[model samples]
Target: MQLPATQAQLSPVAGDASNRRYFRLQLPLRTVIVVDAPPATEKNREFLAVDALLAQSGVRVPEVLAADQERGYLLLEDLGDALLLSRLNGINVDHYYGQALAILRQLAAADTAAVALPEYAAQLLAEELARFPQWFLQRLLGLDLDAGEQAMLAGLDAALIGSALAQPRVLVHRDFHSRNLMCLANDSLAVIDFQDAVLGPVTYDPVSLLRDCYIRWPRARVEQWALGHRDSLHAAGLLPAVDDSTFLHWFDWMGLQRHLKVLGTFARLSLRDGKTAYLADLPLVLEHILEVLQVYAGQDVQLDAFHDWFRQRLQPAIADQSWSGR
Candidate 1:
């Protein structure tokens, strides 16, 4: 309940997708972050829990300096404003991404048996997939799924869920992307926005990192980085021996499940929450989905059917946007 001091200079920081707002405290000796997460809506306790879990696993997370549980306020160590997103470029992406990827590997292998968190199970993953149709297709685009398309979607959902639950379970930073990673002064990446962390597929975090909604990398480049990560996991003894092709397949499909969920989520954020900036990013996400469908659809009849429907139905909607030429 106690603050860092009686008073301190404060300034607003850029916001994220959550209801929580942040402020930077300019103190005499040290700067810190103050979070205003509404108790009714935001899970401050979950954030605290996950923060501790991440820290224990040697992943850099903002240290909680002060917290008021009833008031939904928290003061945390300042990890600075240098997001890995801003620092990424052709010249520095390798270094920045290497640091960020190492943090992700640490997070995935983090001990979660003692923590009480939701499992990213089949039902949950399917519910996220349904968001695509419910919010994006029906709500945002005012489109309906026909019986055939619905059947295809159902099959696709089953395939996705089966793939997800079949993977080695670990603590997944449900939204592991450049935006949520802070590049520290020491060049290490500090994770934030981790309240939604879950016991889920090992490939989930890497997929978010590689096929990010906010940034696009060449397919070949992404594959090389991903395979290198698998090598890291194997060397660390976190992942069992597996063929490269199989691991890459898991990473690709995991990306599909995530992008499908993101499409619906961004639409809902725009239409319902009036956060229209997210709409600008939907095209990139759509393209990610389309790109993945190209590689995997031939292997599954359901995926092929859904891919055809999306190409014929959804692609046109996105084509109107300047960013989507496909």
Candidate 2:
């Protein structure tokens, strides 16, 4: 199959987002992914930035074979079909996690100078969490957070934000999960969807991988994997802190902040982006949130109360929706 130079003749391939199209192309020397991100609705500038940054960091991301920024066309190296999630059956969870951790280490090691990435600052965290009120609570759950409830949430937001800003900062793969990791040839992994990469706590990406909203793993097992990752980062001297337990605290706190952001993102995707597939993953995300809240019990009174209320009201409604819709 000859590769089409223009988007007009490429074969239709499976894609996502109501705004863009993707296609597989075959040339004499290579197979590539052609992304048609129409300028009217979508832009590929971030993708370009991410590709360059990952390549500079020695991570195996799809190479940008060619691009037409004006037309929103990108020809990317075609990483094969086996995703890490698909190969998990009966596999050694420890070893597979080792590979994932290794890849993350490389990404975290990326040059901090590459591009300006967002920090999981107090303002950003609270802004993201506010989506919970707008999308999940008001739109999805259809409930008004009365002044009392709102004040309770305000407290939790303040505490969570303070905890987030106190952690060490590093490169965070905003969506580091199984689906975004490609199982490349020779037992390697290639990272994807890193356009939203940011500078944040080390635990950010690990939580995204182990406690992924799309898939659930036992907390005990996930913890074990996370410890191993922490050790790897420590051994490489990539971390500012030296103590394992201290590192774990950073990870857990960062995770709490991320889960809150994800809950809001998933709800926003469903209500605003018309991407309801993410809604199905809300429970798993909330489970992570509750687990963090429970572990960090003494942090903030308001946070605990909001999480408590979340379990009492939001949990039942989301669970019921999932069951009845099924």
Question: Candidate 1 lDDT, tens digit per residue, 1-326?
Answer: 34466667789999898899999988878888889999999989899999999999998889998999898899999888898888889888989889878887887677887789999988899889999999988998878888877888899999988888888887888999999999878777888999998989988999999899999999999999999988898899888887888888899989999999999999888888899889889888988988988988678787788889888888787666553555
Worst 10-residue lDDT window for candidate 2 reads: 1-10
Q: Model 2: how far is 210 from its true place, Å?
A: 1.3
Candidate 1 deviant stretches above 4 angstroms: 1-6, 320-326
What local lDDT does model 1 show for residue 60? 87
Angstrom error at residue 310, model 1:
1.1
- Which 10-residue window of candidate 1 scores lowest in summed lDDT? 317-326
Provide TM-scores for the models.
0.94, 0.88
Angstrom error of the Cα, residue 304, model 2: value is: 2.6
Best by TM-score: 1
